[model samples]
Target: MTGRRALRAVQAASGLGGLVALGAASQVWLRVAVPRDRPLPDAALALSGRTVAPLVTALAVAGLAGLVGLFATRGWGRVVLGGLLAIIGAALIAAAVPHAWAPGPAAVDDLLTRPLAGRDPTRAAVATTVPGWPLLAAGGGAVLVAAGLATVARGRRWPGMSSRFEVAGQRAGPPRAAPDGPPADAAVWDALDRGDDPTL
Candidate 1:
């Protein structure tokens, strides 16, 4: 109804959408890039096992919190939701930057047929100097950050429609005095017969 209410609605929708996108991306990355069969670099494996999974779980929780906050009209709830979104975005960026900027051994060696008999090469030696994965991850992270920011902004003016309704009621005021005649409505006519000016 009012601008604030409309904004809250928009923010809620954006936050939910962003959260869903982030979750989907994380799941896809894990399935394709961190599959069980693949021998992840030590660092990559460690991060995926110790850092990324927890972060994803946290982000999902935050998304749910944001949705609840939107409905509850609680200020602190919205803030927490926004903060969660930020955390998720930051985690994505952190994970993506290394992958994008520094090519790992997996980037160069053919995973399908690479021999395991020889000494494993360092990520620096086998890393590809491309900006593909990083750019995609960064872009997605930026969207999430933006979504979080939007949620916080919208929270500032939430429940605006309630205020509008109150103001409208106030403006309508008490009924005006009717002209010296029975009012048109049958209800008013009954009041008039009872020596009461229903308009007043």
Candidate 2:
């Protein structure tokens, strides 16, 4: 297609990718909590490891901000934003890949005694099997990275906010008051009066 149209297409793809990334991240966080029995025999269970919520949350927010910058910032600013976006995407992919395929025991492994691995583990103590959500997150991250790279390459040519979007300029000095009769005239002088104490 045309050059501008291509640029817009890239922009649109990037936005879509960012949204997917956010959704996938949320899914990972909400559905994938690893269960680990507390170190103490009687303490409450503690969860940790293989959890991507914080990273995902951070990337998701970054994705949104980068999207805004795509339209709000220009030149170097846009380029910098694009670079950051790419980094976030790369992080997502890196974070999720292992979980999807080779997910470690996460917190569950740490808490359980060697026997826990073998015993028809108690429902309360067992962690959920690594789900496919991580794969989705990784896919989303990949899209974000690709789009971000495109943005970095052609962001200068991409469209941005209109000139009208800028704040209105302020006048150099305070506005001149509307003409009132004659300045310093008798009528204007409340205390000091005119020769006749001019009728108000």
Candidate 3:
């Protein structure tokens, strides 16, 4: 594809990936239930991806912000940002992969136990892996990696912010006259006052 089209595609993919990760992080990755005696209600704990892997959420947000930076930057600046995005993507993948595969009891307990310490001194919460959200988060990370790689490879040629504003600013400045003549005033009244023919 052409540079501009490729840039647009990469940006769109990056945005999609960021949104997917954010959505996944916000959703429940695990459901924990504490088994109790007949008198107590089983405490239902919904552990979101953010709680399990905070890095995923943080990196996803960085990726989204980098997407905006891509439009504003070009050349080496864009390459640097792309590299940062790639790092963020890789971190997200690392954070989500383990949880996606097998969120073991210990891992779950270590994260959930502290909060339940005061509520239930003897917490035997069984955590069921939701799996879907983590998988989606990993998928998003993969997409972000692809986008970052593409940007680093080809973003130097992609169009930067429009130069129309710069051109407009130049145009708005005081008009210059031809080197061969005095500055020509376009006002008819000025020509008449100068005892010159307005028609000419």
Candidate 4:
């Protein structure tokens, strides 16, 4: 692949990976903190689950779009990526605010105890005893938001092989040889030129 295409691939992969990580974290939080076994108050559970599912799905879809977009070099791909990042960032901020302002001790206790049902609660209890848990939670959320923002920024610069080819073609450089010897496989070169994997 050309340098630009490589860069775009890296950006897409990183964004996708970050989004997946964020989604997984959110899933873990939901599974742990939210009462799963007991039926939730209809409105609370439905609203909560609804809010989270979309954000996670959006992020995952955005990542996938980014990957496809990189290859297709379509404006729509960037739009999808940008939109997903924006939604994910907004969700993180919205979720974090409540956690940030929550009663520190109670919130911490709930988070800690909710996860472990029958395990030794002493160590967990001690850990939750610390102050500033809300702040910590908010900070963690902010970090995820920042990561989402970074992914969005990277998406905006989606690179492609065509641009690289134009630049390289313009530069004054030494004549290059056909790697496979004289009368090279023009088809292979053409495929590579268009950002296809020659090995495939």
Q: Evaluated with lDDT, which candidate comes out highest?
A: 3
TM-score for all predictions?
Answer: 0.43, 0.59, 0.77, 0.34
lDDT by residue (1-200, candidate 1, tens digit) is 77566655556654564455455444323211222222543222212211323444454445555555555554666656666666766665665555445434454343223334333343223332334434554565666676667666665555533433343236445755556875579877887685554776
RMSD vs true structure, all candidates: 10.5, 11.6, 7.2, 11.9
Q: Between prediction 1 and prediction 4, which has the larger TM-score?
A: 1
Q: Which candidate is the best by TM-score?
A: 3
lDDT of each: 0.50, 0.60, 0.80, 0.43
Give the alpha carbon lDDT tens digit for every residue of 1-200 in model 4: 55466455555543555454344434323322232232322111112222323343444444444445445543446545555545654554454344323234354454442243344333222211112332333343344344345445554554544544455557556855544643348867886886644554
User: Which tens-of-lDDT digit does each residue in 109-174 have in candidate 2?
Assistant: 444434432233333343343446667767777877887888788877666665444543432445
* TM-score of candidate 3 against the unseen true structure: 0.77
lDDT of 4 at 52: 27
Give the winner by TM-score: 2 or 4. 2
RMSD of 3: 7.2
Better of 1 and 3 by lDDT: 3
Q: What local lDDT score does residue 110 receive in model 4, on the 0 to 100 scale?
A: 48
The alpha-carbon deviation from the true structure for residue 199 of candidate 1, after best TM-score superposition, in angstroms, is: 30
Off by over 4 Å in 3: 113-123, 166-200
3 versus 4: better TM-score goes to: 3
